[model samples]
Target: MTTKLLIGLDGQSSGDRALSFAENLAKLIGTAELLVVYVIEWSPYSFQTPEENAERHKRREEEISTAMERVVTPALARLEAAGIKAQGMVRHGNVADSLDSIAAKQNASQIIVGRSTETGLSKRIFGSSTANLVMGANVPVTVVN
Candidate 1:
């Protein structure tokens, strides 16, 4: 059976590196499919009142969809041009959880993620999402710096 790869893209340089790494791996394992996912981290305090929060959440979802259109749509087009069948998905939740859910839902054999560029105390103070996925995912996870 062909291996399936899921790549977590955060619109950063590290994310680009992860995509390139996944592409190379895909080439080595022919017939594999690629799924690119972006998670929109949702904040609960987006509004003052419950009704306002609902409205704000709806607006934020639309904004996230628009942002994905700007980034993922073109990126997928480029991938298709390079002869890779690619699909993009957006989810709202904790980054690591969203990635794991996608991987499970797609039955992904492998997951590619980018190591956080943050270092030193910052990395320590603010835990890395990639680190969480590396520890949490059920399938094999490859982290690219």
Candidate 2:
């Protein structure tokens, strides 16, 4: 059976490092398929005007397309160029939950993400995606610095 690895990317330098780490690990594992996932966060509980609610679905699709073009597509191209069998996806949800869902759905053996560089108030308030994944992931998680 082919092994699969799910990677979470946020279009940052740390994300680039995570992709690099996952790529090297995939190479070492042989027969491993990489799935690069870029998540655009959305909160369903937010109050919205009727017009905004009416356009929410369209906005969600646009967001996914934008993420694919701006993030997933380039990452996919690089992975393909490196000769790694790979695929990509754009989803909207909480980061940790989305990654876990994708990993379970794809039967991924591992989940990899980058350590966030955010500090101070943001770090304390929002915590980090890496930490959430480490705490909640069903599979092993690798945090690339």
Best by lDDT: 2
Predicted model with the maximum TM-score: 2
Could you tell me how far off, in angstroms, the CA of residue 81 lies in candidate 2 after the best superposition?
0.5
Clashes of each: 0, 0
Query: Which tens-of-lDDT digit does each residue in 72-114 have in candidate 2?
Result: 9999999999999999999888888999999998899999998
- 51-128 in candidate 1: lDDT tens per residue? 876697688779688858975776687678778878898877788888998999899998898886556884697577
lDDT of each: 0.82, 0.91
Error of 1 at 107 (Å): 0.1
Off by over 4 Å in 2: 120-122
Against the hidden reference, what TM-scores do the models get?
A: 0.85, 0.94
The deviation in Å at residue 124 for candidate 1 is 3.0
